[model samples]
Target: NAGVTQTPKFRVLKTGQSMTLLCAQDMNHEYMYWYRQDPGMGLRLIHYSVGEGTTAKGEVPDGYNVSRLKKQNFLLGLESAAPSQTSVYFCASSYVIGAGRNTGELFFGEGSRLTVL
Candidate 1:
């Protein structure tokens, strides 16, 4: 089974264009996260979901939105793409420990690279 899958591995968008990045996981993980990586700076969390139909803002959630409609799927959306938003997006999932804490390691997708002009 595919552990995690991200769609549109690569994408280019104009300044105001919008796009959605899809992430799917075969593993029944209760915690899923979206992160963006840029040069110099390390990965930054964008948005995350603790379970199906439950989502929360992460460290850097501005200009983006996330949804977890199904247990195995999480989607990230960019309403208006910007050059500042250009980065490699990674999707990860991990099992939740007791009290909803995540102690296990995360499984990450290959990553989706986005470039906005």
Candidate 2:
């Protein structure tokens, strides 16, 4: 049971609503990422953090905010939800396996499905 876990697996919100998705990992991984999966668009990175207390924007970060205040927790927040934001959100974590390089094998949570009306 020592892997990534996401809270509120399913949620529905109206336009302009706000919510936060919590991701916790007991594996002590150094890198954590938030991604959204949409029909035919595949998985797009929203935000990521390389270590505790640090975060950075990813490919699709316009409407999302992320925080990595603790080593084991990463939070993704939507300040204003929109219908276009409806998608399956995934959290992943991994650690570097070799010298300055990641193994590219991420442990993903069961995902959070969000629907905006």
Candidate 3:
């Protein structure tokens, strides 16, 4: 089973354009997250969902919005694309965090490359 999948592996958007990146998982995980990786930088959290119908903002939530309507899908949207948003976006999922579980590990998709000009 695919852990997580993100559509449009590559995208190029001009300034002011808008787009949504779709993430889906078959594992039925209750925790899902959206992150962006820039060159020589660690993953920065954008948005996360602890469960269906519940969403939260993370470290860097500007210019982005998220929704988790179904248990298996998390959508990230950019209202207006900006050159500063050009980075590799990654979709990740994990089980609930506990002291002894593998909650510290994140299952990441190949990543969606976005170029804003």
Candidate 4:
């Protein structure tokens, strides 16, 4: 069902270059998230949205921006790329299975790898 899909599976950029990663989900989930994975750091949240037309900063929101204008899509933009931003980015979406509670279950995209030179 194409639970979650991330575009540009891999990319390389020079300092100051710009790019955008696209995430699309068909599950119509209420929550969407962007996370970056680095060695030994697991996954660190960069941004998230509770629903369409709403977004919020996450654990590591710097150097990145996100937009969720549509319920099925989430876009992550790097205005000016940097070496520190080189990592594997993942997009996830989930729904609340219970009343006002999240089970911490997420359906993730394949991942987009960004390399900054």
**Each model's lDDT:** 0.95, 0.95, 0.94, 0.97
Encode model 1's per-residue lDDT on 58-99: one tens digit a residue. 999999999999989999999999999999999999997777
Q: What is the TM-score of candidate 1?
A: 0.95
* Tens digits of lDDT, candidate 4, 4-117: 999999999999999999999999899999999999999999999999999999999999999999999999999999999999999999997878788699999999999999
How would the candidate models be sorted by TM-score, starting from the highest? 4, 2, 1, 3
> Could you tally the backbone clashes for each prediction?
0, 0, 0, 0
**Taking the tens digit of each residue's C-alpha lDDT, what string does model 2 give over 12-63?**
9999999999999999899999999999999999999999999999999998
Segments in model 2 whose C-alpha atoms lie over 4 Å from true places: none
How well does candidate 3 score on lDDT at residue 40?
93
Cα lDDT of model 3 by residue, 6-101, tens digit: 998999999999999999999878899999999898999999998999999999999999999999999999999999999999999988756565
Candidate achieving the largest lDDT? 4
Task: Candidate 1: list runs displaced more than 4 Å.
Answer: none
Candidate 3 residues lying further than 4 Å off, grouped into runs, are 97-102
Clashing pairs in 2: none
Instruction: Please list all clashing residue pairs in model 3, or write none if there are none.
Output: none
TM-score of each: 0.95, 0.96, 0.94, 0.97
Listed per candidate, the RMSD to the true structure in angstroms reads: 1.1, 0.8, 1.8, 0.7
Candidate 2 lDDT score at position 51: 96
Model 2 — TM-score against the truth?
Answer: 0.96
